[model samples]
Target: MHSVDHRFVELLPTPLERGVLYISGAHDIVAHLCLCGCGNEVVTPLGPAGWVLRYDGRVSLSPSIGNGALPCKSHYVIQGSRVHWLSKMTEDQHHRAQARDRDAVRGLNPTRLGRAKRLFTSLLRRGRV
Candidate 1:
C-alpha cells in the first residue's frame, strides 16, 4: 500500500520521481514511475479511449493500469492518491485486456481515432507504448 503525490504541470519532467503522479492537462497526459518499484516510467494519455483522471485535492484515475508489456507487468488502480494492487493476470487475461483496449480505440469517432493512433505512435516512438 502506497500513496502518491500529484502535481499538475504543462510538461512532464524527465526522470520522473517515484511516488509522484505528474499530470499535464495541456498535453492531456499523465506520467509516473512504476509503483512496483521497477523503475519503469508509465504514461497514460487522457481521452475517451484512455484513462480518465479526477482530482479534488487528491487524484484518482479510472480503470486500472496494467503494464502487460513491461517486464514487471504491474497492475493496479490509483484512487485518492493511494495505490490499490491487483492480482497478476494470466496470459489469457492479458490478451483479452489488450483486445478490449483495441476495441475501445476502434469505438472512438474517426477524428478521435486518428488522434488516438497518432498519440499511440508518438508513445511508441518514445518506446513507452
Candidate 2:
C-alpha cells in the first residue's frame, strides 16, 4: 500500500498513485460522503474497495486521492459507512461485497435499512443524474 501523508484531503497523488474505494469495505478506502460535511461528523459517501496500486479519478462519482493528497476522516472509506452501493466495480468483487454488506446489515438494526435508504435517497434527490 502506498504510504500517504495523513492530512486534510487535497488534490494530489500517492507515491504509488493507487488506492482502494469501497462501498462497504474491510480495508481503508476513499469515499466522498454523500452528505455534505457538517461540523459534527461526516456521513457515508465514501466507500471501500480492494486495494489497488493505480490511480483513476472519476470526478462525478469517485475522486482518487493521490499519495500526496491528505484525506479527511470523513473521506476514509472504512467502517460505519452505508457503503452497500457503489458507482463502478470489478464484477467478481462487486458480487462479493454486495453479499457481505447484505449479511452484515441483517439484524444489525431494524431501522438501519431505513436510515441507509434515506441517506441514498437524499443524495439522489437532485432530480438530475
Top TM-score prediction, candidate number: 1
What local lDDT score does residue 129 receive in model 1, on the 0 to 100 scale? 48
- With candidate 2 superimposed using the best TM-score fit, by how many Å does residue 112's alpha carbon deviate from the native? 2.3
In terms of TM-score, how similar is model 2 to the real structure? 0.33
lDDT of 1 at 6: 89
What digit string (tens of lDDT, one per residue) describes model 2 on residues 1-129? 212212224321222122222222321223332221222211123332222222333212333221111122123222221222222334554456457556655745656556655645743563211
Q: TM-score per candidate, in order? A: 0.89, 0.33
List the global CA lDDT of all models: 0.86, 0.31
For candidate 2, what is the total of clashing residue pairs? 18
Superposing all C-alpha atoms, what RMSD in Å does each candidate have to the true structure? Answer: 1.6, 13.9
lDDT of 1 by residue, 14-42 (tens): 77888999998886889999899899998
Off by over 4 Å in 1: none
* Candidate 1 lDDT score relative to the true structure: 0.86
